[model samples]
Each structure stands twice: as structure tokens, then as C-alpha cells.
Target chain A: MQNTPHTPSPETSKQLPELFQLLQPHLKALDAFLETQISEFEPEIRDHVAYSMDTGGKRIRPSLIFFSGWNSEGEIDPNLVKLAAVVETVHLATLVHDDIMDEADIRRNRATVAKKYNNATAVLLGDALFSHAVYLATQFPTTEVCRDIAISMRQVCTGEIMQTMQRGDPNLDMETYFRVIDLKTAELFRVACHLGARLAGFEDDYVKAAGAFGRHLGIAYQIYDDMTDLFSSEEKIGKTLGTDIATGKPTMPLILMRDRLPENEAKALRDTLAGNIEADVPYWLEKLREMGIFEEVRQAIFDEIHKGRNAIRPFQNNPSAAHLHTISELLWNQVAAL
Target chain B: MQNTPHTPSPETSKQLPELFQLLQPHLKALDAFLETQISEFEPEIRDHVAYSMDTGGKRIRPSLIFFSGWNSEGEIDPNLVKLAAVVETVHLATLVHDDIMDEADIRRNRATVAKKYNNATAVLLGDALFSHAVYLATQFPTTEVCRDIAISMRQVCTGEIMQTMQRGDPNLDMETYFRVIDLKTAELFRVACHLGARLAGFEDDYVKAAGAFGRHLGIAYQIYDDMTDLFSSEEKIGKTLGTDIATGKPTMPLILMRDRLPENEAKALRDTLAGNIEADVPYWLEKLREMGIFEEVRQAIFDEIHKGRNAIRPFQNNPSAAHLHTISELLWNQVAAL
Candidate 1:
């Protein structure tokens, strides 16, 4: 963890108003390609699926997949776009199912597919997305990328299962948390890099570079997730705050705080974690804050994002890779500001 | 439902010995492909998934898909192999999830994935299979194939939900049952056919024939399932008899028997359906037999299967398509014998 809080000082944070503009042409073509691909379905299913896909998700993973390839192989080939679509579809499938498993009512400020259409429909739709992803991975230029992407997907499932078990467990260790995060959050990002690089036929050092960049950015991205859970506004962050606490998952901040707690205070924190979500929220929040655990967690998030930015400093000169590098820095800056 | 009695009747049963033999080659391929795809995961997770797929359950859906192509287009292209594989995986995903939802200890004479693994793992494993199926489907050569497959997969999920809600209700109308069966079992079969026809690029009346064949066969298949539940050998059946009754879902005979039952007996049957699985199985079986419901159901099973054979007969010239037609007849013959 760093000295900065969840609300970072202006000096560390940056902005990227033109980033979307920069990526617009490729994004447009990607959307057009997907539209043509999906237009033949039962209209409602296709519309709902595309609605989720084009929900303007930060194209972070796809960008990594694209840029990693370009940096490694010196061009963004047609294969990168297809791989991008596949990776994004895989991510979308997880979100659709996660909403059902979590019973989450809202995501990205919209009714989740599970909430909007219904769980059964959501499950099927998610399966549809997943099926599309697997089918598309073969479109990648090589069998190697196909195999790696598919393996990463199974790893995502492993991560989801691991996370499901860890939920509501205050005693969850940091190792388990990282293991889960790495799978749930980082595996795709890591794969995104590898896929991009692989598509470019960048067989060695560049592949490692792409993967390393994604790994650090993914860590930074997740630390931002932790910070958002604790400190971001519902309007700005797009969901409820302290949701992890509400769900009783011992997230990074909470984990750091538990270790630092006095025995009696730690027991209080543990009790709150073990308590049912249907119980009193204010009482639990007060207890958590009274223990000074929240502040420690806030700082830990900033430190991770800071480390993430530093990790990418080596790739700044590559203009083709600039958007991805910029987004990582911007997200971290926003987390610090928040 | 048709006229088979609630006793061993192996002497009259028909077998798909030759068709199953023809399918043997592809079955081997399926096994090898599954091994390669899952071999990379940790052994524990790999085994959990493999236990479900590796079980030598019927490959009805895949056969339908391949045969649909074989019949309409005159040959089963090797390229369409993965399409069949994906459809089967979708079916297996539904079954794995169904086992958990049903809490069944056994399927195909062995423990289900849920029974073998804990419920949490089993649930996620089902999700993984669904994801993997989607991933696999993306490899289809055309976008329409992708969208059509997705639509069919959606139907399967909806069918499962319908079945769950209708479980244990003797009053479940036959129309509702038909719809449920169509969604749960028939839709995938239809998709399999649709995929087969789509891949073969039949692009005409052939598509309609393939779909019609699949839909009718799927219905016949479910009808035969009803007969098998009441009349087949415990060993031959691979699981306990009258399990659906135990779960409270009214099959054809039960539905008929409910209407035919003397007031007291009808009330008793209804009570059992509404009650827990702990209710005496023998008691219901005895009462059900006294009404001759089993015989009535078996006759109906024959009627449907015979209809299915007629529907699929147009494909008789193609070897793979001919086998599906023959298998449908044989399966029906087995039910009629029972």
C-alpha cells in the first residue's frame, strides 16, 4: 500500500478525454463486424446481447490484445480484431452469469441482463456469448493462441468458483484473495496481451512484455476496484460502495486492516464480516470505520495503482501502445482522485 | 406415452447396435477431443468436468445435428464436427446443472457431477461447460450458424426453468408438458439439426426437413423416455425406475392415471406428488400399476416413435442420416417391447 488515500491528490491523477476519440475508428469497425455476425438471431436475444456488449465497456482488454500484438509484431492485423471480439465476449459471459450468481440488480448503471430479462434467460444468453467466444478463438491466426485463450477461459471459471467460496468469509487470506483476483480479474487481461502478441506472431520477448504489462495493469485495475468498493460514489462509481463489506468478503483493505487490528477490535471486524447482509448496515459500517481499517485499505489501493503505473513506464514511447498505457494511468489517477 | 408394462421386457426390446457401432468412430474422436481440451486444467477440476462428459450417455443431440446435415446435404463434412461437439456440450451442461437442481445422486449408473463434486463446484462446472460450449460454437464457419445455435441454446435454458416450475404437479397439462419437453429436450435436438443443415449449406427445403425431423424425433425421444421410466430393467435403464415420479413430474401414464383414478387413489397420487421424495415409492408404484397406467403410456410411446420414424424417413438415402432414422426406430421398438 502507498501513502496516498482512495481519494488521490491531483498530482498523481491524469485525464484522457480524447482516448475514446483515438480508439473510435477501430471500435466502430468492431461494432459493425459484431452486428453483421449477430444479426441473424431471434431479434430480442441478439439485441439484448449486443446491448450488453456495446454497453460501452472500457475496451481495456481489447486494447491490450490489439496493442500488445502491434508492439510485438509492428501491426494490428485483422486477426487482432477477431481475438478482441472473442476476449470481450468471454468477459461479457462472466458478467451475465455473475449477475445471476450474485443476484446483483444493477451494473454499469443499468439493470443487469439477469435482472432485466430474468436469470434463466441471462444464463442462456451468457452461454450464447461463451459459445461465440470459443468459436471465434479458432479464428485467431494460430492454434497456439486458440489453445492459450481457451485455457485462460477455464482459469476464469476456476477463479469465479474460488471467489464464490471466498465471498462472505472474513477469514479469507491475502494469498487466496490474490489467487482469486488473478484469475477473476487478471487472467483475461494477461491473455488479452498474449492473444494480441500471439496474433502478431510475436513469439518471444514481446509476448513476455505484453503479458507483463497486462499483469501490472490488471493489478492496478483490481486495486481500483477495491478502492471503488470502499470510497467511490454511487453516481460516479456506478454501484453501491463497500459492496464487498456488505457481502462480507475480506477485500484488500479489510485484509490489511485485520492484520493491523487490536485483538478486541479485530473480533469486532470479524463479527461484522460474519454477520448477515440483511442486518443493520450503519452499525457495521461504523464498526469497520471505528477500527481505522478503511483508511489502511484506501491507502493500499493507491499504492497498487502507483506500482501499476511505474510498471508500464518502459512502454510509453510506443505510440501504437499509447492508448492502453494511457488508460491504465488515467484509471489509476481517477481512483486516486475518488 | 405407450403400452409397455412395469416389468422387465428385454425379450422384445430393439437395439441400435449397428447405428451405435457407426457412431463409435466419432464417439472416439469426441473422447480424444475432450481429453485434449480439458487436459491442461488441474486434475481435480479436469476430473470434475470429465466425469460428466466422459460418461457414455446417449449423444442424441449431436447425432441429430450431424444427421441433419448428412440427410439434407448428403454428407457429413468434417468441418461440422465441432458444431456437433458444441451442441453435445450444451446438452451436458444442462444435465450437470439439472442434476444439482434435482439433487440426483446418480445419472447413467454413476454419480452425477454434482454428486461427485460439491454443489458449489458442480454449479460452476456447469457454467464452465456452458462457457466452453459457447467458445466452441464461435468456430462455426458462418455467422448465421452462430446466431441460430445461440437461439437454440436459449430455448434449452428456458425449457429447464419450465420443467423446474412444473415439477411434482400431476395437474401439469399435456400442452405445457409438450412445450417443456420441446424446450428442454427438443430445442437442442432441433438446433443440432439446424446446425447440421446450416453447415452443409442446404439453404432450401432441406433445412425445413432437417428441422421437422429433429423436432419430431425429439418428441418421440421424450415419449420413449416416459416409457423407459416405468418399464425397463433397472440394469438396462441405468438408474432407478419411476425417478421422475419420485421427483413429482407427471409423465404420460401418471397424467392419464390421474384422470382415470378412483377418487381416493387419485387423491393419494396427488398427495405423493405434492409430498417429499421420502414418500414410499413402492406404494405409488403399486397403485399406479393397479390402474394400468404403464400400459397406456407405453402404447403412446410407440405411437410417437413410429411417427418420428416416418418423419425422418426422407433422409434414408444418406448413410449417417439413415442411421438416425434407424436409431429412432430401434429406441422406439425398445420402449414398445418394454
Candidate 2:
């Protein structure tokens, strides 16, 4: 099995969505700004800092920040650029630590910090990255940016801790699952949009709406990600399928399947999830397909995306809202295609 | 050998120094303040946060802050209390992460967070604590507190990373050792004193001097800690001795001993540090005593303490400076007792 779930890197323009073309200059400034931050770290760990910062993920959170703070002048706001770097750096730091916990060797087609260095170095490096992110957040004029970023970071770790504790538990409920995703993934998304809009001098009402839009969109994105772990083919996703089941992570599809199966079958699946029995990935995959869990999970994703769209509907006249809607449309298209 | 070196917990009045008696109300305020922080964590992980924060170690950093910001009015400054909590929390967070890297089962006379829960939980808990610390730092009106704290946190992690990389390396020099300790240990101490004095509205020159005092005092304290890991007895220190040798961590005494040994003996010591052979800890310990390395290392610590005293000597008329001198004297007494 592949080490990590595959996600297309945003290195090439083709891999990015069409809306990203508008963010070309913003992202360019972000990349340059991030490059300058390597020197901010101590000389010894600068190489590791640079390596982790070069993750090349799709930068979805940065996109949220930029779009929510979009200006009519078409000029990059250095403050927004700094905010993007802060959020992206925090995301990258989480990824570094996550790789250690998952014991995964590969990330973005390169050796993870845990694999390249060691777990100890990976842990400390992740910490250094986190500290640097907060340091960047403190550069803002007011305490709001750092305060929001810090709270979001705490929530993100709390979500991850909850997930780790529930890893092999077969009875993780749907509500708990949603709560975890909200804290871990959506919290940062909410903060990015909220802070970006606030920093851009948006009206209070519009900023609140943007944050709600981001929260719902984040939920939708995580559901889609979890769905791909089970439903997508190795060829389609460029990574191994059924990893969520293999690793005994009770995601939406598996949770739904477990509840729908016969008592005997459900007991067997529970044993598999609890690691009392060897994981039969093919059997579970076949069972999920036969039970039509895929369509059910897809609907859940659509529902979240719809709710996200409804959040910003009242502010359609705002340019920032329009840009945010465009980003959501890109996600909608991806989900519909799947 | 025991899993970790022991430091006295400041739970008892007798265990504390004469000055801490004066700060009883201040320490009580810090405890109450820290207790309030527990609810700030997510409900799911509050127990773990509480567990890690109940370390009961000598709150040296907090003491530094309180002393550096001492007021003649004898009223506890809430800002100084918040600052103390921030630095102390950062210290505890580092200890949690350090326990994981050391794989030590015990810290401050209890199961470490890594041992009590798991490495993954410990990692995330440390992260949560760090975020909370920064969040508290942001509560101050200006960004200076958060900014200095973030930078110090980064340097602390950088120091740990360097030390981790240098593990089992036989050729680590004195200069690198000092550099690592300065980054890992002294940076926070320096920041605590600097910020404390600045927040108390002291003269700029005195603030700088206080920070210098803290830096030298931190150097002295770490040297004393490393000495305890090798020279002190399990009964005396209440944990273990010679762990540095067992763990292949080269400290001042070990380094001095290694360099002073005859060529063949030095090669064997180097090999032991490189983990090519079993560490004959008793032989090394006896050799350390025979060669008078204890006195040599002790002298190094005394030199740093003297330097710290000199840094504050010019500010003798100030109450804060006098308090800082008394703290240095406590360290001098501990070393003298050893």
C-alpha cells in the first residue's frame, strides 16, 4: 500500500483549478514571502524548515484567505500574503507531525520528515514550524490575528487528539465524527476566512458570513477526502484505496456500512476495525459497493457544499463573496465528477 | 538507572527557598490562573492538559519573571502573573515533548504524558499547550509579548533539534554543547527576564541587564542539571545518576573527562558514547572522581553564576535587581551543597 493518500501537488499550473489563475500573483508573493522566512529560523534547522515549507499542497486554506480578502484594486496586500504564509505554515507543521503519527514515509512524492530524519527530529521540527507560524501571526498590527490563529491551532490539535484516541474504536458515532472534522479541519478554514475578511476591512456582517461559508466548505472538503479514501480506485487517486478501513479509521462510509449490515456481519466488521481480526480490504470494498454507501456519502458531501453556498448567498453583490462562490463551485465540480 | 534525572518539586514550603515565601500569594495566583486555563482546552482533552500541567517542577522561569518584575509596593501584578504563566506553560510544553524524545517513563516524580497516554497524544498535547501559551501572550495590549515568546519558542525547539541530531556523536565539542544549551534553555530564561522587566516599566538599561543576568543564570542552571545526571546519587537526587552515560549524552564532566583521559582510554570513552560498546558507567564515574572532573565542571557553573551576578551588580539600588541577586544566590548555594 502507498504510504500516504495521494493529493495532486500545485507545482504545475495545470493541476490547479481555473480560479487559481486569479491568485497567481498572490501565490507568487506568498512563495517569495515564505522563502524569506527560512532565514527567520535558526541556521541549524533552516534546511528542515525549508523542506517542510516546500510541501506543495493545494493550499486550500491560503485560497480561502485570499478570496475572502479579495480587493478590487488587483494589487496584493502584503498583510494578506503574510496571513496566508502563517496559515499555510501551520498546516505544513500539522502535516509533519501527522506523518510521524501515521508512520507514513512518503508525502507529496518525497520522504516525510519522519522518514528522512527521525521521529525525534520530526517532532521538534514540527514544533519549530508551529512556533514560527505563531511568530508570523504576531507581526500583525492588532492581537486579533495571533489570537485567532492560536485558538484555531489549539482546536486543530484537539481534533487530531480525539481522532487518535478513537482510531481503532468501532463505535465512533457520526456526530462525534463531524465534531472532530469541524474542530480539526473546519476551525482553521473558518479562522482563515474570518481573519482574512476582517483584515481586508470588510463589514462585520460580511466577515461573519464568510466565516460560516468557510466552516461549511471545510466540512464538505473533509467528507470528500474521507470518501476518496474508500471509494476511489488506486488508479484514480494515485494511491492505495481502502486505507481508512485498513487502518481501522471509522469514516462516513464505513460507519454507514457497519450500521446497515446484519448483526453477524456487523460484529465481524467491528472485529476488523478493532484489529481483533485481520483487515479484509477487498471484502469491505465489495460490501460498501453492494450496500450503496458511496452514493450516501456523496450526498452528505453535497449537503455540506450546499449549506456553504447558502451562507454567502445574502452577500452575492460583494466581490469577495463572488470569488468565494467560485472556489466552492470548483469543489462542487470535483465532487460531482467523482 | 531511573528513566529521568530528578529535580525537587516545589510543592512543600521547606523545599522552596526563603524568597518563594514572599511570593506565596503570587505563586497562588499563578496556580489559580493556570487552573483557569484548563477549561480553555477542549473538553475531550482537558484531562490530558491537566495531567501535563501538574508537573510540580520548580517553576524557575516563573520565579525569574516574578523577581525581575518585583515591585516595592508588594502588590501582585496581574500582568506579571500572566507573563509567568506563559513562560511556565512553555517550559512544561517543552518538557512533555522532551520526555517523548528521551522515551523517559518518569518526569517530576510521575508518569510523563508520553508514558501515561501515548506519544501521539503527548505530541498533540504539547502543541495545544504551545498554542495556548501564545494565545495568552497575545492577551497583552502590544504584540511584543507574543512576538518575543514565539521567537523564544522557536529557538527552544531549534536547540532540541540540534541536540537530538548530535546524539550518539562522539566528537561533539564544547562550543556546540554551549550553543545548544544557550538556544534550548537560556533563550526562554532571557526572554522571561527581559519581558518581565520591560512589562514592569523598568529603565531600558536595567531591562537589558536583567536579561543578561537570566542568560548567564540559565547557563549555570543547565550545567548544574547536567552535573546531577552524572555526579549525584539516586538517593540524593531521588531519581537516577549516570543517566547521561547510559543514554550517551555527553555533558561537561564527561567531555572534560574524555579529553583528559589517555589516548586509548579516551578512544574507549568515545566508543562508549558512540554506543559501539556497553557503557561501563561505574568505571567512568570513578574515573570522573579520580581526575577531579567534578570540580572542573562545578567551576564552569560557578563562573556562569558569577557572570550573572556581575550583570545585575550595577542595578543594586533597584529592588528587582536585588531580588534577582538572591535568586542567583540560591543557585550558588545548591552548587556549593553539591
Candidate 3:
């Protein structure tokens, strides 16, 4: 791995907000399309689906789709909005099921679907959303998008299954950790770009490049997210924080820390995790912080971000490609604060 | 609606087992294909998936696909085996998720996925299976089968959502009940036939007839299933029984009995259902049985069978179509004894 000190400054973070401002109209269109798509469901399901959809997020996937679609040098397809809804609904469906699996209460400062209704309703609701997303993908004239979506979906579930299987293993290797993230996070990003570029009628090379950019960016984003979950305050994140340890989920920081620690201390930490240490989590968190593991995690995030930016460096001069670069930089700036 | 007394005799029911004897080789081929399909998953997931798959049911969906595929007056495509696996996997995925939603323990005389594994693992496994099934569907040349699968999947979920919404409502109308079964049960059956016939290069009319056969048979199967759940011994059914009542699920017998009883008695029964009457279930079951609700339910099952068989009556002389009719009768025989 090439180590480059290309961390973004605070000013780099402001660019995304401006981009968001420029892209606000497209986002609104996606929102409307999503609402209309979900309206066909039964009234009860419609309410639950709307509730989950309306729970605001950064809309990162839609931005990727929109930006990638805009790169085609043609008028963006109206169908792109529908595609955005499909991807976002897919994202939302995964989150709903994730919340249930994690037994999480709050997400985006609100009760999770599993908590809001019940597990049974939440499970069926997730299934319904997934089916709806698949159906939406089928509306496209080509089977290519549906094929990509299906493969990406399978990979996502594979990641989840891998993660579930490896839960509580603090000694999980960095390779396995990266593999999990690659499947779980990066595959969706890769397909989002793949779909966006293909739908925009881009040639095969640019589509491949776009997918690479997304893959690296997604890996970087997930590493940064794992770091934030460990280091940031629950209030700052506006959702459940430090849950990776509590749930015995093997994430980057834990894997790194376990690898670096003395054998006895690593075993002790694992024992604590294996035991009823829910109340003792703060102590472990403080110890890991005092050990400066967060600094190492931050460095790892920067390395990933640098790799992500370099993948798209060839097209950085293009205005549309520059926007993608700026998004990567913005992600770096957010993680640098940790 | 037509109360025809065209019930099958024991001799007709006996034909299915003989057919199964002849079709054993095809069933084994399907089983082998299913194994290969699931073998691609991670070891942990592979075990869970295999465990769930091996805890066999009657292979009804695959039989539908196979019988329909064989309808063409030409050689059967090797791809049909993969399609059978896809449909069966889809069926298995739904059952896994449904078990989690129902908190069911036993299925096919063994522990359910949710019981054998944890709910989280079971949920992810179900999702992985669904994705795998979709991926398998995409392997075909045409987009039509994928679209049908996606739509059928969405409709199935819609039915589940409708059923979830109407839970505990003893006054669920017959029309709405039929609609739920149509969406949840019949859609898959319809799609199974549609795909099978399409794959076999059957004519459009035969395809339509096969789908009709599957749809009406699916509705009849669900009705018979609900009746079996109400009246059969758990040891005989080899699955958890009486869960519909415990979960407040509205099924045919309850609906029919409630509609047939005196208003005051119906209200009392509904109150008992709505309130804490877990221990009083035996008393309610006795009352319904004493009221000859089982007889009414049996008659309803026979009526549905008549309609199901009638849907494919045009091709009754064809060997393939006769097998379809025999399958429906077999399902009827199982529930008739209840």
C-alpha cells in the first residue's frame, strides 16, 4: 500500500454541501419518484415504507448515480430518477433488515423499523422493499441493469452472512475485514456506478473507470464509518455508536488493535468482549483511544481515500469527473477530523 | 363459489405416489442442481442453507416447473433444472423468512432456520438465497422470466403485508382473504408455470392454461393448508400447528365459522380470539369442530380442487396435464383426511 499524506483540509469538506446545493433538484426528483413507486403498496406497508424512506440520510448512492449519469454528455435520462429510487430503496431495505439483526433502536435519530413496529413486520417490510426494488429494476428496457443489481444484491447478502458468521471474533484478520467490506459496501457502490454509466450510454472503458472509483471510495467510506462508530460521540453521529464492539462485530479498528496488542492484553480484551462487558465498554473504548489506535485508523482511511482519488485522477480535469474527485476529498476531510 | 361434489376418491389420490415413483429420477436431478447452486455460498452459510434445503417438503414448486417444462413436444432444456432450483430456492428463502416472522420452530419435522440458526443469520441466509435465485433467473437468455420472478416475488410480499395488516381481525372478508392468497400463494404458482412453460417452448395458450392450473391450485392448496393447520395433529403435519391462532392470523376456517355463527356467538368467539385466550384454544377448537366447521372447510377445499382441475380441463387428456391434475388431487387428499 502506498502511503501518501494527501489528507484533505477543512475547506475540502465544504465542497460537498455546495455540490448538494447544485444537486438538490435531482434529489427532489428522486424523492418524488420514490414516493410514487412506494404508493402502490398496501396502505399499512406504504406507511412503514414511507417512514423508512423519509428518514433522512446523506443520499450518497443517489448522488453517485446522478453524477455518473451526468457524465454521459447527453441529457440525463428521466429514467435515472427511477433508478435512483431503486438503489436508495435497496439501501433502505438493507438498513431495515440490519437494524433488526443488530437489535438497534435508533437510526438517524429515530426508532428503527423493528422497534417502531415489530420484528415480524420489519422482516416482511424489508422483503417487500427488496422485491419492489427488483421489480423497479425490471422496468428498464435492458436486462443488464437487472443482472448487475441482482449480482450486487447477492454480494451484499454474502457480506452480511460473512460478517454474521465472523461475529465475536476479535482476532479477525485485516484481509477478511477488507473482504467483508468489499462485498458489503463496495459492491453496491461499484454497481451504482456501473448502472449509472451504462444507463447514461457511456462506453465500456469509462464505465469500468467509474466502477473502480466507486469500489475504492466505498471501501474508504466504510473504514471511515467504522472509525466514527468507535471514536465519535453518539450525539455527534445521531445514531447508535460503539455498537461494533457491543455486538462483537469485527471492524477495522478492532482488528488492527487486536493485531498490535500484546498477546495477554489481546486475550483479555477478547475475554471481556465474550463476557458480559456491555457496561464495561466505555473503559475499553477509553483504553483503545489512549493507545492511539484511532490515529492508525485515520491513517488507514487516508490511504484508502488517496487510492480512491488516484483511480479517477486521469479524468480529474473533466468538470464532471472533478465533482467525483471532490466527493472523495469531502469524504477524506470528514474522516480526517477523527 | 360453485359447490360441486366432484371430490377425488382414494384411487385418484394413489396416482400421485405412482407418478412420483416414475419422476424420482427428475426429482433427484433437481436435488443435485439445488446442491450445486448452494455450494457457492460460504461454509457457514452453506451449512445453514443446506440444512434448510435438506429438511425437505413435497417439492411441489419444482414439480410444477418440471411437469410444465415437460409439456413441450420437444426435448427438455437442461436449463430447466436450473430454473427448478431457482424456484425451489425462492420457495426455501420465503419459508426461512416466514419462519422468523412466525417464530416457528418446526417445519418438515425439523427445526426451522430461525430455530436452528439465530434470527439474524436466518434473515441474511434468506436474503442470500433470494439474491441467488434472482441471479439464477438472470442466467436465462430472455428478460421475461426475470421480470416474472421479480413481479411474483413482490406480489408474494404484498400478500404477506396484507396478511400482517389484517392480523387479529376475525371479520376479514372472503374477498380480501382470497386476494391475499392470490397475491401470496397463487402468484408464485402462476410464475412457476409461466416460467416452466415458457422455458419448454410451449404455445401461449398452453402456458396460460398451465398458469391457471397453478394459480387455482395454489389458492386451493393454501386453503387446504390453513385447514390442516387448524385441524391436523402436529405430529402428523410435522410442523408447528395452531400458530395461526396464536399469532392472530385470519384463515379460512375461522372466517367461515365466524360468518356462519349467530352474531352473539361470533362476537364472543372474536372476543376470545382478541383477548388472552391461549389456554382456551382447546375449548374454541372443540366448539368449532362441534359446529361442523371442519366439514364446511373440507367442502370448500373440494370446491377449490374442482375449479383448479377445471382450469386445465382443456388439456386433461395430455399426459403432462393429467399429472398436474393428479398433483392437485394429492394435495386435496392430504387435507381431506384432516
Best by DockQ: 2
User: lDDT of model 1 at residue A57?
Assistant: 78
Please write out the lDDT profile of model 1 over residues B248-293, one tens digit for every residue: 8887767777777889877777777776435567776776688787
The total number of steric clashes, by the backbone 3 Å criterion, in model 2 comes to 0
Look at candidate 1 and tell me the lDDT of residue B330.
59
Best by TM-score: 2
List model 3 lDDT by residue over A133-232, tens digit each: 8878878887777778888888888888888878877667899899999999998988887677678776677778778888888998998888887898
Tens-place lDDT per residue, model 3, B129-217, is: 88878778877876787778877887888788788778877678889999999998988998887778778777788788889888988
- Stretches of candidate 2 exceeding 4 Å from the true structure: A1-18, B1-17
Superior by lDDT: candidate 1 or candidate 3 = 3
Candidate 2 residue B261 Cα shift, in angstroms, is 2.6
Predicted complex 2: DockQ:
0.81
Q: Which ten residues in a row have the lowest lDDT in candidate 3 chain B?
A: B5-14
**Candidate 3: regions farther than 4 A off:** A1-4, A7-18, A42-44, A72-74, A239-241, A276-279, A316-320, B1-18, B42-44, B72-76, B233-235, B238-243, B316-319
Candidate 3, residue A193: the lDDT equals 74
Tens-place lDDT per residue, model 2, B266-295, is 999999999999999899999999999988
Ten contiguous residues with the weakest lDDT in model 2 chain B: B1-10
Pairs clashing in candidate 3?
none
